[model samples]
Target: MDTILDALQEGRLFELLDNDKTDALQFLAHIIEAFPEVPAGTDVVGHVMKREEAMNTALGKGWACPHARVPFDEDLKCVIGWSPEGIDYGAPDGKPVVLVVMYLVPENQRNHYLREISFLARALENYPGLDKLRKVEDLDDIRNYLLDLIDVSKEPSGPDTRARMIRLQARTAPETLVFQDLSNLIVEPVTLVAGQNTEPVVLTQNHALFEWLDSVKDLIGRIETEGVYQNGGWRVVRRGAVNYQGSRIVYDCVAFKLIQNRPEKYK
Candidate 1:
């Protein structure tokens, strides 16, 4: 779903053009023309126009990502276009628009389309060194720059790393669980050693909690007898939230549970 990198790698996404918006539209038409299953020529233009009637996808960074969720059999496709001279498209900033990245996605593919839009939104949000975008006159340069930027963006963003732990499904409600940066959670650093038993296992889902415990099963199994942690495949403690009176204390901390569950509501 990462932009420019995914688009260029897909091969059919790139489109070189002169300094004009009409060319941009025509180029997009050509790209859709190649996909005969979705009709052709002016039909593609009609799709774009219909979507545009709802709202301008242009957020005004001298760029716009016009998109439509068209009915199709396969995944999504992107058609990239550039105009060096820039054209008046009534951008929010009242600036002339120079580049257009059109996204055509299948209606049924909600996740892929949303993910692609998210990636595109992030890329455009940074608007980092967009003067480079102004200079790109052909498809090759655009492809190279886009690929390079996407590569740079992959180097472990802190929030992104935390978010990676939970494999969120598209149909899953967004108000149940969320990723919160531990760095932001505390006023100062709170370092805990690996041996710290008091450290709470904070997770919103059953799988995540189980996964963490499963990863450190050896440590848990040998804690009482050996008083040491070792890598071994052993049966670890499984608290089913049923036992009231037991040799060891095992109770769900409502604070930690609430902490893990609250963030998704805000999102």
Candidate 2:
């Protein structure tokens, strides 16, 4: 459940275009192709569509989780398509599907994916916000809604990081990744450090802070910049770009947790 929710938190959530179930599934699958975790030349569409033909993935109550299995070993990644105007997804209960949570299952994460899905299944059974989620028009509302599924309220976002963490839900236009936490100015070519072992992401509207990053991106890969949402002194190793449905550029990075006390690192 946290994995799916975390995916949405890290900007994997998108407003789906109005179309049939196949189109929606393809739409989500196409997004999955852009994920850094997914291997290049991997036929995400082919695999998902082929699997769909064998068994329908339309989970009743406006949710459809279609998945594809890959041979590579990586984290179980997913992208969600939120259709405000539901699509006719040929559900067993004869209902339109609104949330399409498509997953890319890796060899190592099969058990983990199953566990998350199983937990999500039970949680959704009693989740009392179906009608509310159906009416969600803004990405901010949608993100906040899902994050609340498993309240991280207890997870102690210390005062030092509390203010920065609050901006994690960067507000955006209906179908755009337009950053708004910094007065909606912009975070173009957003370099995301995929918190594989630490905090979820590091997105700042202050591009000047990373101006040197673009200049040396080709020369060096994982040069740590002065912290922005840099929690627990983790090492954010830059991987590469992860282009999504929107025009916004995203990079996949893994943050390895470690303890440190470097005052000079903080700007």
Top model number, lDDT: 2
lDDT of 2 by residue, 1-267 (tens): 656655654667767654457666765675566454566568787889999999998878888889999899988888887887887888888888878889999889999888777767766777777667777787666666666544532223223233234345343334444222112111233455432333324454434434433333321223323112222222233333444553433554333222234223221
Q: Which candidate has the highest TM-score of all?
A: 2
Candidate 1 residue lDDT tens string, 158-215: 2333223222321243432222222111111111123345443323234433454445
As a whole number from 0 to 100, the lDDT of residue 127 in candidate 1 is: 47
Model 2, position 133, has a per-residue lDDT of 74
lDDT of candidate 1 at residue 36, scale 0 to 100: 32
Q: In model 1, which range of ten residues has the least summed lDDT?
A: 183-192
